[model samples]
Target: MHRNHELYEYLMKNSWQMTEDWYKQVDDPDPNSLYSTTDEHIINTLKEQNQDYFKRLHKIFIEQEEVFLKEFEEWTIELAKDQKHLDTAVHYVVREFNKTQEVYISYLQKFYKENQDKVKLEQFFLWLEIVRKTFQLSIYIYMEEAQKNTSKQIAAQKEMINELSSPVIMLQNNVGLLPLIGDIDTARAKLILENTLTQCASLDVQYLCIDLSGVAIIDTMVAHEIFQLINALKLLGITSTLSGIRPEIAQTAIQLGLDFNSVRTTASLANSLAAFNQ
Candidate 1:
């Protein structure tokens, strides 16, 4: 513990230089990195964060060596859950964090070289163990938190796409137009059903014209989902018309044994809109 305090005192006094060197490396980073594009405010915030960390770290290392990991935990979690860091690419952050680790190891080596008489072998091991464990734990939490944030962003994007793809435009009083384009998969088909119904209710649509002119093909299940969507609309008291269903989709609907005889359909969007006037 005596040697631990000796190393700690040395590090406490040199923490500012160590932190400054870490930031110097982080500033220029890799050429293709997000760090290169980061704003000045964020850079300043990062510097302040590092300064706070070093203050806490120095005190813990010198006064309560056994509690270093616990003392460092809040700082680790703050970095992990931080929106700015989470928004940056994971690989870029990892590269910079590894560089910071290198800075520490180098600082320790420099310390040993200048003060060989003050350092013991076991003291070196204690320093190494604490640095390695604390930083590794921080890295693990950072990666896990970033992955979770990414997953949430992806899910939110998919939902926005679904809402955008299925749109109901009001053509007249109590009438709406829904134009569906692209290939229909099970997931997309489900979105179409949900969004169309919600839009109809929101628009107070009594009749809806569904145009599928851009759809080239759809599987059997997708066809069934569309047919089911028509029936569902009927329950909501909305008159639904289908148009521009390609021949392949028709065949697939037939193969699925779907009964659409009662559902209204037209050859094109023009014809469907014309039928509305009559």
Candidate 2:
């Protein structure tokens, strides 16, 4: 009976000590009902009961460690299947996980420096996996947000192109000011021609100015089109003046052998307007 009491006391003391150690290691005391807490408590109790019991507990712990390590190795292999040529978010997650493993290894080295206990290493390895999984989840969230932002920007650009391609502003009768915005693609050119021709016909403006100040570049096709439009306006008995041709464009025009015969060119809209008024 005395032996039984002594064994009970020793078991309780050892269980309490194990709990304290676990708390110190994790720094957070889980509810005693938690699986981890319950497992540790049971193991501690069994180990303190008899010498054979302690040996059995150690063997069980080793088995559990082996299973966990196998799982961990498989998880790591799956995560790093295609890290090198990773183009998508999944690949990016793999790469980040691989990077996190390096950090995890460093942490393990730091913690196991003095103790060199296999049990401690196993525990820490499990903890490291928990951290890695959490980090991977966070990276997935970040990638989702990045993809959303990219999609939004693409949608906005499409809307902007639609607005620019389809005429957003109506020309007032007798108003000759045409402010061009953005790159002058073929669609934009057609829109400009339609608007300008309509305005000229309806407004009966004697002097028409084609402003090119906002134009970034004038390729051969653009120059040829402009020349054709100018000749057509002349046939309609209207004088067309080209304004705001940059020196670079002038050079390109000369190089491309584009002739602007009898089509008046000016440095600015102000100069063109002054010439028209004269």
| Candidate 2, 1-278: lDDT as tens digits | 01123223433444444334333333213343221244666545423332322222222223454564455444434433322212234543344334434543444445456346433556556645654554564355445554565576678776567455434132233325555555676655665676566767777766677777877788777776677777777887877788898787788888998887678888898887777777
- Residue 151 local lDDT, model 1: 88
How many residue pairs of model 2 clash at the backbone?
0
- Residue 40 displacement in candidate 1 (angstroms): 2.9
Question: What does the lDDT read for residue 53 in candidate 1?
Answer: 66
Candidate 2, residue 232: the lDDT equals 77
Q: 1-278, model 1: which lDDT tens digit per residue?
A: 53356666777788778878988876655555556757788677777777676667556456664576676775776676677676677887887778777877787778777877877767767777777766677678778877877788899998898889889999886778999888779999998999888888898988889898888887767877888888889999988899887787788778877676887999889888888878
Cα deviation at 170, candidate 1, in Å, is 1.7
lDDT of each: 0.78, 0.53
- Candidate with top lDDT is 1
